[model samples]
Target: MSNATPPGWYPDASAPGTDRWWDGTAWTAHTRPAAQAPQAFGPPEPFTAASGDATTAARSGTRIAALAVAGLMVVGAAVTGAVLLGRDDDPARPEAGPSGSAPPSTTATATPSPDGSPAGNDPEVLVDQLNGITLPIPDGWEKPDRTVEPVPTMRTVDPYECPGSSSDFCYHATVTSRTASATDITSAEQLARQDITAAADRAYEKNIVGNRIHGGITSHDQLDSAPVSVAGRAGYQVRWRVNTAKGPGGYVQSLVFPSTVGSESLIIVRYAFDAGPDGPPLSLMDTLTKGIRPIGDSATSGGVGSSIAP
Candidate 1:
């Protein structure tokens, strides 16, 4: 018998609850126990259902499903490992989904750092004394002008460095903090998202980035937004995209958390980048976010902090 189903896992001809490997040319002896969802785990578990549906919006809402642990499984296929899990739908990545799509990862897994402020002297990191927010900047990233005053902005941190045209080709990271009243925002997530939208509005109105396909100028296509915790505090995050001079190059993500000074103040850690299919993606920004830490907090201990969604 001949099989022309392309090289992939197919229902085993002889076994009812199993899948056999088809090596493009012929069926191989390799067989594994099968279920409705073909995951990279051995012995099907109850959670594979949710992880298999990770592409859908509903799956992202229910991020804590036990099977999601296996979502990052680096198994059998490189394409599967690279595409399906970790962070999917990044506009900056070559594998990003259609326009106005958000990354599949709604929540960031917080990796804890040492207690009471990171070693501030390290040049790789940028610390905001006013807001008490610290960012682990990548190498070669030029610092924001010392004279930018009040609103601190870091330019040319993007993988695409444009010599004087930062306002157009490259992305800028800005730290904005504001006084929050009880009625100002209901949740940390709301505040963060508002700040993100505000940033996008400024960019679009100023021609920093172009308008999104379905959304008007100063408006954006929100891919995903959720409440998350970073540095042991309540936080909110949003991911969105807009049009840019370079095709579809607007992918923006912002993490908003409380300032160390008091609950009344909120800090917005905004990441702006080119989400186009070309150039580098948000991987560098992800690395920066994972390394974010607070400069002063006695409650923070030396051990790594676990990331949790509040």
Candidate 2:
């Protein structure tokens, strides 16, 4: 050991799944179990169903509210991988759902024109070039400045400190869009089902940085999962009302479809909204889903889809 090896813990070469402490120079025999999730969130096993209808009162119970905006899936986490509808065994390392994650795509951010669109040259639209679709910036929402964060999303409120933990921040409502996989071969239904779990985990359970923003997720109910369409293309969706241990837990959804551009890469859109009276009405999910349309195409309301009841 060097004279100045900084006093701290380091992975033990002699042991696996354990950390050895280094007082400064020599390694100490004292060891502890290695952190289950020290960095990137691993894809967790599918979670079992929780007993309860998705309701406002559901937030009152002491269930852990997880999964993000990375954020309770900031929507970004959902695009990645993680567990679904399962109970998180370890509260310290929240299980992946939105699944810790990805930075939003790079886009040109400009002042909202009178029409109020938040990306590129279109004053009324945010174009997701990777997915070859457009997401309408509904009333009371604004496209965030692309430079502030890489996510290609719209937010109902500005970023604010998390109510549960000061180290983390949150968005009362957020919708993120991205492409899931260009190389994988899978049906949209399967992809959406898998991704939403991660989204809920990554966003609310704990952000990519591993901060449990909503007091950490305890359980979730699969509110809805159904076939649908986006931008006139075949798609599917899964919605869950994730219960947290603190604050007003929230609802998160993942919608998957094939992109129109390139080789038809799969596209996923994630949504997160706080639970209780302070949060946006759940119908907004249906309203936003109906608002998606193809870029340069005027038609909205891609097709019939499931709705979350109040």
Candidate 3:
């Protein structure tokens, strides 16, 4: 016998209570009532190799493949009709948790809770389970796409193709949430200042493939930099008005604060909006930031304060 399940009958995954014949590698059309099937589904009769190396290798391969499927993250602009923040990459660290839960290294691709299930659409807020924080979603913002991995995000309007980069999509405004890198201890002010440039670039400079979507950022000016409280934690935010070579450039802001739950690692929220008259109102930034709250089964919205002290 080989490592493959010996030719036998196994339960049909598609049809309940029926067993389908397994011709070793795949299921044959033959089916019969489960009561008539002889062997239970699983490893077949003992193979010739006593060492069992082939079976062990096959099982290991299967496990790796499954893990790979579970770890993918979605970048908003990368997909069609996704009205959330879009970036080729984010400088992030895996989310810290009690069970040591984390996502793929620097990408900060939010790993679902150990339950690993979609949290579903909340009409008013987007929950970041990994960060233990919730962001208020304005009325017109597109809710997180439950079909994609649950990364905390929301944006204004439906998505559209980049002016020239048809392969990628664009959003007039988008907000995103994720854990910040933990390698060094840095104040929220420093982190936010350092991040605005990258935030601006990711939003309007170019498409994922280096195609100039908004032509390219021609210049940028600091609009605001201030100390603020976030989710009851001392935090800071920086905003910029970027000029683009083609379309109406946009404003980008980086806000950093501490997570109220678990390890208390830093959390970063990014916002990007087009600058034309149709773009989102600049006041929306302060509104969303003020709505940040901790998430829990019985959590209530206290309304994040804007003071420098907690």
Every model's Cα RMSD, please?
23.2, 21.2, 19.2
Per-model CA lDDT versus the true structure: 0.44, 0.59, 0.60
List the candidates' TM-scores in order.
0.45, 0.57, 0.58
How many pairs of residues collide in model 1? 2
The better candidate by TM-score, 2 or 3, is: 3
**Tens-digit per-residue lDDT, 97-193, candidate 1:** 1111111111122111121122223344455544445555554454443422234344454434332244333344333323343445656777776
Count: clashes, candidate 3? 0
TM-score order of candidates, top first: 3, 2, 1
Per-residue lDDT tens digits for candidate 2, residues 208-252, read 777777788988999999998676788899999988988878999
Candidate 2 at 157: error in angstroms? 2.3
Q: Which ten residues in a row have the lowest lDDT in candidate 1?
A: 98-107
Clashes within 3 Å, all models in order: 2, 52, 0
